[model samples]
Structure formats: C-alpha cells, structure tokens
Target: MTISLKYRIALVVFVLQVAIFSPLLWFTFTAYRDADLQQLQTREDVFMRLVSQLGRKALLTAEPTDFQLFIAPFSKDSHINRIILLNQSGIVVASTAPVDLGGPLPVQKNERNTVWKTSEIANATEQLGAITVHFSRAELDKKVEALVKRGIPIAVAGIILSALVGLGLGSLLTRRLKALEQATRRMGAGDMEVTVAISGNDEVAHLAQVFNEMSGSLRSQFDELQQVQQELSFQAQHDPLTGLPNRLLFDLRCSQAIATARQHKQLLALLFFDLDHFKNINDSYGHQVGDAVLRCVAARLTMALKDHNLIARLGGDEFCVLIEQLEQEQEAAAVAESVLHMLTVPLECEQHEFFLSASIGICLYPRDGDDEVRLLRNADTAMYRAKAAGRGGYRFYSHEQTSSVQERTSLEQRLRKAIERGELRLNYQPQVCLTTGNLVGVEALARWSSPEFGLVAPEKFIPIAEESGQILAMGEWILDDACRQMQKWRRDGSTIPRVAVNLSALQIQRSDIATLVRRTLDSTGLPANCLELEITEGYILQDADRAVAVLQQLRDLGVSIAIDDFGTGFSSLSYLHRLPIDRLKIDKSFVQEIGSTSRAAQVAQAVVSLGKTLGLSIIGEGVEQLHHANALREWGCHEGQGFLYAPALAPDQLHLLAPFKRLP
Candidate 1:
C-alpha cells in the first residue's frame, strides 16, 4: 500500500524509457525494410529490361534453341528462376525448364517465393513474342531475416542500458528523500533535535532545510513552554508578595506531614501566628510598606525555624509552621518563643522602622488534634487566646479553650436566631445633668434574654457577634428598636432629651453605617437631633479619615456623635478636632478611680478640661458614689450616669421614672 520513493521513481523512469525507445526501435526497423525493398525493386527492373533486349532477335527469327540457350544462362543467375521467349500467338518457344517448351506460357497466381515480369520483343514496328523472367523472393527474405537478427540484439541492449540509467538516477534522487523521511519520523516521535542533511538545490533539499529550521523552532518553543509551566506551577503554590508557600501548598504539605506523623508515631506540632495589630500598620502606611513588612516577617520566620520545619503564609498576616519529630511537647513552646524573640527586633522598610509583635498558638500531634484541620483550628483558637492575653506571647492548646470555642459557636448560632425571634430588647439608662440633676438624655443598652441561657451578658455575646459578622444585623436591629422606643416615649409624654445607641467597630468598617442610621431615622420618623451615636475611641482611631467622613455625614443629617471610652484608646489630638463630634464620655475606669487615686482624678479632670477647651460636652460614666459625682461636677463635667442614679431600666419603668429628679 505504501511504496518507497526510490521504487516509485524507478518505475516512472522505466515506463518513460519504454515509451521513448519502443517507438525509436520500431521506426528503425521500418526504415531498414523500406530501403531493402527499394533496392530489390531496382534490381528486378534491370533484369527484366535485359531479358527483353536479348530475346528480341531470337523471337523474330523463330529460333527456340537459341532463345533457350540464351535464357538458360540467365536462369543460372541466383535472382532468376527461369526465362522464356514466346511467339506472337502466345505460344512458349523456349524455356530454361524443358517442361514449358512448345506450350503456352504458364500463368503464376498467389505465389509466395517467386514473381513474374514480361516485356514485348519488337523490331521496327513488327510485333514479336513476349520475353518473361521469373524472380525469386528467397534472397530478399534472407537479407531481411539477417537485418532483423542484427537489430534485435542492438535494440535489447539499448533498452537494457536505458533501464539501468533510469534505476541509477532514481536511486540517486531518492536517497536524500529517504533520509528526510526518516528524520521526519524521528521528529514525530518527539526528537526535536532530528534534522535532515541538505545536499542539492532541488525541491527535496529545500524541503529538508525547511524541516530542519522548523524542528529548531519547535524545540525552542517547547523549552519555553516548559519553563513557563514551571513558573506557573511555582506561582500557584507560592505567595507572590512574600515568596512563601501559600495556603494551598501549606494544606497539601500539612496533610502529608500529618499522615507521616501518624504512621511513624512521631510527635508533630503546628504553630499558628499572626502579627498583632497588623491592620493598623497597613492603615497608617501604604500597602507597599505593608507588603515589605510581610516579606521581612516571612524571611525572619524562615530563618528562625529549623530547616526541616515547613513555614507557610496562610494569607494576610497569618502564618503556620509545621515542626516534626519533636523530642518533647515543650519543644513546640521553645520554637514559639524563638519565633517571638526573632520578631522582637525592629524591622525597617521604606525608611521606616517597625516594631513587630505576634501572637502564636501551638497544637501538638495526638494531643491537641489528630489531623490537620483540627490542629489548625485549635492552633488558631490558642492564637486568639494569646492575642487576648496581650500579644507577643504564645499559648498551647487546652481542653478549656476548645470548650470555650464550642460554647462561643453555640452562642453565635443562638444569637443569630435570637435576632430573628425578637428575643432581644433595649434598656434605657438616664443621663442626668450634673449641674441641675435634670434628665438630659438616656443611653439605650441591648439586653438578650435567651430561653436557654437566661439574661446573657452583653460582654459575652457582643464580641461573639462581632467575630461571627452578625453585628451588622444586630446593630441595625438595636438602632431601629432604640429609635422606635424613643419615639414611643416621646408620644407617652416622656421628657428624655435624646437616646444614644452604641455602634461597634465592625458596623462602621464593614457597612455603610451613615446610610443605615439615616434609613432608620426616616423609617422611625425620629428627629435626628433626638438620636445620638456612640462609637468607641479605639474604633475611631483605627481609620480616622474614613471615620471622620462617616461621622461628618451623620452630623450633616443633624445626628449627634459621641466618643465612648475616650481616654482608654490611642487618642490623637491631631484628628480629634477634625472629628464631627458633639460629646466625649470619660471612661468608667477613670470615673471609678475618682475618690481612690489622685492620678485617676487628675486624668478625669484633664479630660473634662480638654472637652471644655474643644467646646465639646463631657459626660462621666460609672459615677457610683457621691464623691464621684461631686468630683465630676466640680471638674465641670456636663452630665453623669451610673447605678447612683438608676440601673438601666425598661422603657415603661423609665417612662414612669422620667418625671423624678435625682439630687446628688
């Protein structure tokens, strides 16, 4: 089915040779035959003319013997078979053969070997008998046979020579083609180095040259593609900014490490840590600086850990370390301490020095968890515990922490449903004018009374709600409920001036809090001036510019803004004057320490004086004793609130008590 190039070329050449030589050989044979036949024709004509001239006299004399003598000699010639002289009456007078003497001339018809010719013998218009001559074809046949015998060998030799030349040419031409075909096959089998040898300027040689160039191009492209694939694979597994293993690679290697640890019964530890207050750095500086810091942290961590231990960036400022073949469980703590110590040194990036600290959590194999997921989760929980206990420290996994996490998770689930089931309510604590004991405003406090856990404290569930991202919904509900309650109190003829509702940092950061407040006010038909929003000082300082913008929007809508727990956070006077604020609440710690410590008293007095200087109203919180209230009033505080006046009361109770004035 598949013919080789050499054989195909040979066949084509053989066919062409046959086509050309066959016609040439045939023409040569034909021309030789024609020339021989023409010579024979000339000889026959001369012999007939000679017979007619010699026999004329004899025929006129009517001498048969003389004619016979003359013809007999002519017949003896090889070309002549017989000669005769006839009388005018058509009678045979003489013949070389005696059988034809004195008989009419014999007629020859359909003869193979001989032919006859006749001529009239006349002298001076006197009619005489005809003379006849018989010519044999045997000599012509012998000459033609000899010619054919000679030409046969010559034609065969010429044909054979032509065939040999064709075969040789075919082989010579196909040799390069065959080599190219083999090279093509090798290239097809993935040998990009394969190339054909070029020998001539013909099409096949050009084709080989083109194939070689194509093979080189393909080899180069393949190498580039392989390199690109490797780079893509590395990028997929590595963090682009820090050049650390990403979460995907970390998970894979962690799984593998867990399996090995389980199989070999070896101790393994997973350390989870994240930079403390890293968002503040990203907020204060640009993300470029933050990225440089992360890279620096990654490098330090890599150097701090053992080579066998795997350290990976688990996204953001969080990282995980896998320590295997630990001799003791305390080794994990030692590693954690080493990592913390390594981070104690300041890092400089973009010409700024940063003091970095981290909270680390350690979970051991077969002790804290048996698998990667559990180990990571427990380590994260312990890391949070470290952060809560004040950062730059590490904590090991404990059953109490697991119990707490489960309890918090359960609380979070219940809290989500509690908001929908309307189990949450608001209590109003009256804020009295310290100068006149007149009711100025009341702070609306959220209270949750779950059927499963009665009267759950705000401190416990508030943080849980914030962490689980349910604070947005819960904050919205509190704002709406507080506004509606204030409206109802106004309708019931209560003299409460305004109602303050607390806002969490998550609410402001994660949601459009200004819009939410405006919508709530419009829906409740509550006067904006009659509503106040309380945000913690720490939340405001976290992103001061954005916070100022959001507060400015609220102020434009005639809503009051107050800084809650003012002195407890990193307060900056630079942004404080820029804030759209109406009041600053003295932190309860300072209020509680009023009569106990002169330092606390001085701090509170300074806050009040600062508020006065800023032309902002100041309120003292947790004023539990007469001395505390007297101290706040003497210090020129505008308002005061504590159990001294009243505990947070229900709406109806507050309505009932609104008319009464408290005297300190």
Candidate 2:
C-alpha cells in the first residue's frame, strides 16, 4: 500500500525535464520561426525600394529602354518573388513578375501593407511611384522544412540520449532505495534482521545509510520492549518482591481447585499464613532487611509445600497455601504447622539476623465454603484468631470462625455508615485529681449505637474503622463533638477542663492533622488550651522526626499533646525528653496490675519517675483501685483517670459530677 521512494524520485525528475524542455521547444518552433519570417519580409522591402526607383525613372524619362536598364539589375536578384510599380492612374508601369502585372497590385486578403494614393503618403515621395512586392512564402516553407527535417532528428536524438542517461542514473539511485523499501517492510512485520546495502556516495546513498542506522536503533528498542513486556507479564501473575505467585494467581488457582474438588468429590484445604509483627520488623529495621526476611520466608514456604500444594503471596507479609487431594483437614493443618515451624529459625542476611513467626489458618473443602472468596475470608479470619491467641500457631476454620469474620466485615460496613447515620456519639470519661477528687479533664470515647447492631464496643469496630479509612471522618466527628461539648459546658457556667480526644495512627498520618485540629478549635470557639490531643507513643515513634514536627506545631498553637499509653511502646524514654509533649498517660496494662507484686506495677512506677524527671505531667490511667491511685500520687504522678473515679458519661451526665476550676 505504501509507495516506494524510487518511483517518487523518477516522477519528480521527469516532471522537471518536461517543464524545462517543453517551453524551450515551443520557443524554437514559434518565436524563432516568426523572427525569421520578419527578416524575410524586410528583404522584400529592399526589393520594393529598388523597383520603385526604377519605375519612377521610367515614368519620368519617357524612355522604356532607360527604365528596363534601371530595373534589370534589381530583377536579376533571385529572392524577389514579385515586384509591381503603379503610376498615378493606377497602371502598372513596371513588373518584375515576368509579365505585365495588373494596373492595381495583386494583394492577398491578409496583406501586411496596402497603398492608397500619393495624397495618402502626404506627398513625401516627390518623384517616386508606389511599389508592392510579395515574397515567395512557398520557397521559405521548403527551406524551413528542410532545416527542420535535418535539425529535429539530431535534437531529438540528443534528448533521447540525455533521457536514457538520466533514467540510468535514476535506476542506479533507486537500487539502494529498493533495498530500504524491503527493509521497511520487514521492520513493519516485526522482523528487524533485514539490513540495507547502501552503495555509492550520492545523497540517496547517504539517506539509505541513515535509514539503516535508524532500523538498527529501532531493532534495539523493540528488543528492550519485548524484555519489558515479558517482565510485566511475569510480575502480573506473580509477586515482584518475592518472585512467588501473587493474589491474582492465588485466586485463579483457588477457583479452579474448588471446581475440581467439587467435581471429583475430593477434599482440599486453603491455608492463610500471616507473618506476626512483620510491620514492626520492617519499621525497626529498614525495608531492605525486611525484604530479605520476606525472601527467606518465601523460600521456607515453598520448601514446606508439596509439589501439588500451591503457595502464593497475598501481599504485605501474608501468603496462602492451597493443599489439594487432602484426606482430612488435619492434613492441611499439619502442613501449616510445618510451615510455622520452619519460620521459627533465625534468618540471616549479611550480618543481620531476623527472627519471625507465622500464624496459619486452615479451611477445608466440603466443611468450609466451596468458593474462593468465602474460603479465603474464613481462613484469614481464623489466622487473625491464631495471631490474637499469640502467634507461633495454627487454627482450623470453623463455622464460629466464619461467623466472627462475617460479623467483623459487617461491622466494618456499618462503621462506614455510622457517621453518616448520626449513630456515633462521644462519651466523656472524667480524668480527676487523685488528691482533691476534682475533675481535671475528660477523655473522649467514641460510642456507636447502630440501628442494625446496638452498642458495639470500641474494641470490636475501632480497628475495622481504622483500616477502612473511615477513622479519619469518625475522628473528625469525635473532635468536633468533644470540642462542642466543652463549649456548651463553658456557656452553661459549668467549669470545663481540657477535652482530651484520642487520635488514631491513621488520623495523625495525615500531614494536615494540625490544620484540621486548629480549624476545629476555631470553628467550635474552643480555646486551644481547653483541647488536648492524645496519641499513642507507638504511633509517634513510627516516623519520629515527622511526628515530632507535627506535635511541635500543635504545641506551638497552645494545644496540649499527651503521650497516651506510655511505657507500652518499644521506644526508649530518653527520646521522650526531647519530644514537645505535655503529659504521659501510663498505660492501663500497668495501672491495672499496680500493687499486685506484678512487673506491671514496677513498669508503672518507672514510667511515672521517667515522666517526672523529664518535667512532664504523668497521668495514671485504669486506676480502679484506691491503692493504685495513692501509689501513683506518691510516685509523683500529676493526674489520675480510671474506674476508681467516675467512668465515661454522656454530656448531660457530666453536670452531676463534681467540677474543678480551670488551670490558669
């Protein structure tokens, strides 16, 4: 369908030749011949002049003999076709036509000149008579014909020779061009092996050479593209990091396995494997070490699986194993145990060693659901149970387990719609001074009363909400609600302490957390000092510098920041001194066990002393026992909050509690 370069070049060349030669040939045939005709006419004028002089002499001398002698010399010239002299009476006095011409000169219809009278000539010729001459055009035609007959053949032969030479050169030019054409066809067909042979040093040859280089470059690019496409395909069906079958491949295999099992009436098991505290490892060390750990884990997983048992990575420290033709669920459970056991050993990469564990969940065919999504969800739920039960374990999927997962999933859905339904409310837990027993602050706790499921616990739905990104909206609602409550109380003449709102990791992960908090404070008309933002120490330590910067910005705005659940995170207390923190709330885990001769009590005292040494106010949480509150006060804790005092109450219920003056 594509035209070749050779044809195009030849077309251009022939057009140029015709354009130049056609005009030149036209000039030669018309303009040059016309100019020759004009010169012949001028000669006829000379003959006419001689004839006129002879006739005038003859007419005036009254001697025919003298006239003939005068005209004889002019008539001897061969070019004079005809000469006629007319007298005053329009009679022919002399004729050079070899006969007496007519009294009036013979004139052709398209005559060049016509004489009227002596009066018309204005008497310019005194003794001269009018003379007319006609040249022999037939003889001129014969001469012109002879010249053309002789010259045109030679001119045409020269043109033919030049055309042949031009065509030969054009053919030579097209030879390399043809090779380029073939090369282009091959390149289009995805065959880049073809190469053009360029010859000579003409511009066409140079063009061919450039085209060849371009073809080579394109071939290299195509090869790289092929490699990239293959890599993409591989990554599509497999995990790029672990080089193992990914979730897509896992789902495909699971669906097919379920179908085959249903057809053959065979038992199959789907096992979900989760690496325990994998994110913590990744955070403590860098992702590189974590990747090395994952690679080791993948190798262990593959080794533990049978050839028929398929294993795939389900992304982010989670993997799945499909056991085919299993006789019993225990068979799959045994394999899960093997994998968990294999993961226990310390994995070494370079000089670093990582110790990791896996929590495995098993779901069997015919007993569990017979579909991909159902079985995977069931197994994943059981795996979470195993992890919650303390990892280095395996759990078999049961109907109860499936129900729990469905409930959790359903809870997550409801939580998503919770804020929109206006089912969420904030309950204020009073944080009072242990000595004076006066309210110092209130912790904001989110309570959801769903129409579908009434009074869901925070522990049940908070994590699900957090994972679904709904926590951000829910957290914003809590902030506004709590701040509004404080404003309402201040307007109602009830002494209001700081309103402490728990902030989730997801909430603070937003870089705009400070802005959102400031805007909420401004909108609620609540002073920054009256609002407190509480974040767990573990969340703040994830990205210390960034978290510290955000906290410092909030602190500068007169907003109080308390490290909730202190001494529970793995961070060293020394970093706490440098943090722009206002208070440390001892974790309830320690406060609950205080005075029980338990290590939890010692941990609580350590955190209190650490807070005091750093000039930070220490608030003891979960202080249900009077002894716990007395111990915290003796340990220099500045505040206390727990069931030993009043628990969280609704905004209306806060009016009944004893109030304290706001801190200046």
Which has the greatest lDDT?
1
* Per-residue error (Å), model 1, residue 62: 34
Q: Which tens-of-lDDT digit does each residue in 98-217 have in candidate 2?
A: 466445665544433322222111135553456555455665676677767866885686567557655766777777667777888988998976677777788868888888899889
Task: Tell me the lDDT of candidate 2.
Answer: 0.77
Q: Over 4 Å off in model 1, which ranges?
A: 1-182, 240-243, 259-266, 273-309, 315-318, 325-359, 384-393, 434-438, 510-512, 594-602, 625-627, 655-664
Where does candidate 2 stray beyond 4 Å?
A: 1-233, 251-268, 274-309, 323-359, 369-374, 384-394, 659-664
After best superposition, candidate 1 residue 401: deviation in angstroms? 3.1
RMSD of each: 6.7, 15.6
TM-score of each: 0.68, 0.59
Candidate 1 Cα deviation (angstroms), residue 550: 2.7
